[model samples]
Target: MKFLKIGDRNLLYPIIQGGMGVGISLSSLAAHVAGNGGMGIISTAQIGFREDDFYKNPIVANLRAIKTELQKARDLAAKVFENSKLTAKFLDILKNYTPFIGFNIMVATNKYADYVIEAVKAGADIIISGAGLPIELPELVEKGMAVSGNEKRTCIAPIVSSRKSAKVILKMWDRKYKTTADAVVIEGPLAGGHLGFSYDELNELGADTMTSRNYKKDKYDAEIKEIIEEVRIYEEKFGKKIPVFVAGGIYTKEDIAHVMDLGADGVQMGTRFVTTYECDAPDDYKQTYIDAKEEDIVITKSPVGMPGRAIRNDFMDRLKSGPIPIRHCHNCLALSVCDRKTIPYCITDALCSAANSDESHALLFCGSNAYRADKLEHVEDIMLELTEDMN
Candidate 1:
């Protein structure tokens, strides 16, 4: 595989471990992925759920956890290099290794700007934002860099689902901030958590059925191609290479090859990593994916005012009857998208429930191919499996 270039660094593998929230891809997973030469991202979505004051003062807890997690991920990644049995190629790469630990800060989060600044000050190598178009991401990132007193700017990327979104983000960043994305991630309809596409769009693209949406037949492939071409324009204008990575249903080596052949520079994978031993989610949460079948995965409306793909479970089934009563709001999401009184359920509560292993009443977000996970494996094994042929 070609190296994923970000600023001056070269990631040995053009693979990114897609960030999962509510305590799903944290220090352990992020560290291991970076340790293995890919960009490892920690999701900032309610990251402080484990902190004692999470429920009482979530904002402060989450801010604190951002620094804590970044430090922990860096330390763990260092330990991997010091202790783990690594391949000779990896060792060669390690000679000048600078482990990439990124933060996935959603634009829809309540303290979005604070999260970005805090992550930068805490020494995050990169910040990847989505959940909404990060219109002012360049401004926030610049502020963070200035506040951190670091000459080395933190790389920033925006996740987009279509060519239009890509154009909008790139054009706005260039016009407003005199900057463009360091990289871009194209998340397709089949991704997990809150998706960028609406339910109707997904159905129209034949993404609702597993049998109809194979990689060869995926309609989203055309969209991905369009996005790549759109990014190419900005790349030319900025006189820099803004690498584009594709996500959603990217599972095996073949899946990686398919996107790369479509002109993608790399791939972002979330579901495939969920079943890894290094993943931060509870074993029971991982088990849900292992035990899932194609039919068990369904699309549902999210409290964040978006459609999400998740495993159908008791929690999902209960939502069919009526909106679940909101006990309390954590103020995690933006007020514009989620109102406590009207939202169907507390997204933070449901996600935390899943994190704590209460899957029956939890929101278990997953990608389309989550059902294919038959067993838990190591991050090293999965990374090797995906990049073995590339080397």
Candidate 2:
């Protein structure tokens, strides 16, 4: 496999382990991917809650969790830092083992602006933000983080739904931000969690009307190709080869081969990593993916004003029948455009429950192929499987 570079640093494997939230891909998995020659990304979405004190203040839960997760990532990184096994004495030496440590910060999350800054301080090399138009990302990346006691390059990678989104950011960067994008991710309908489609567009695409859940189709959809084509147009206009990565429903080596054949620089996987040994999600969470049936994975609408794909379970069945439960509201009022009361369940409760392995009420975000996951394997083995026969 060919190594890829982010500015001056080198990543031995262009492969990027997708960031999963609420304790899915934690330091263990991220460190392993980086250790095994790939770009490992730690999702900063709910990082801090791993701490015992994460939930004392209900409103600042995400903030507390971010702090906890960053520390946990460092703690779990002990093995990767061992002198007997490729030790990284300086913080920058961490670049060699897992050079491209990234953070997936959702623009939709509460306190998102502050969260982005925290990721940089935690030594994130790439900041990939999605769930909405992250117009302020360039400004965040420019804030800079310290490594080797000096400011390091922080790459901002935005997830785009269409060419229009790509063009808008590029124009904004050129005209207003005075910065060019370091990279971008083209996420499709098959991805886990949120989508970029509209009500009518999704309806025409066969989305269920009463509920916001999505379904699976046998063949590749045309919308994804359109998104990729749009991304390419922006790459051409920018006059810079901004690395384009793709995600969603990537299940096997054949799937990886196909995307590579289509000209994507790399692929990102969230569901696949969830089953790996290093994944920080609870064993039951991992088991859910292992034992799931093909038809069990479904999409649902989040009170957070987003359409998400997840496993069909009792929690959702309960949502449609009764008044949506609300034990507490963070009221962080993170997004100016969002209405906080519209949020159904405290994402904090449901996700943390699932992370703790209580599947009865936890919100499970999964890709269409999550049910097709037959076994749990090491992250490196999956990497070997995908790249073994690569040309």
Q: Which candidate is the best by lDDT?
A: 1
lDDT of 2 by residue, 1-391 (tens): 2446565466655577888877787777887776655677777666666565455654355655554555655555545444312223234544444435778888877767777876776667788888888898877655645322436677888888666787787778768876667777877667787667665555665643322234433223454465566666656776656677778767787777677667777778888888887888888899988988866776687766667778878887888885466776544336564465566666767777788877788889887678778888987677667666542
Give the Å error, residue 324, model 2.
Answer: 2.9
The digit string of per-residue lDDT tens for model 1 on 1-391 reads 3566787667778899999998999999999998877889999999999999988999999999999999999999877655544445457656767778889999999989999999988988889999888998888878988998977788989999989999999999999889899999999877888888876777787775442243334578888999999999988998988889999888999989999999999999999999989999999999999999988888788987788888989998999899988877788988887877788888988999999988777999999899999999998889778877765
Per-model TM-score on C-alpha atoms = 0.96, 0.85
lDDT of each: 0.87, 0.69
**The 10-residue segment with the lowest total lDDT in model 1:** 209-218
- Name the runs in model 2 displaced over 4 angstroms: 58-98, 144-149, 206-239, 332-338
The candidate scoring highest on TM-score is: 1
Root-mean-square deviation of each candidate, in angstroms? 1.7, 4.5
Model 1 reaches what TM-score against the true structure?
0.96
In every candidate, how many clashes are there? 0, 9
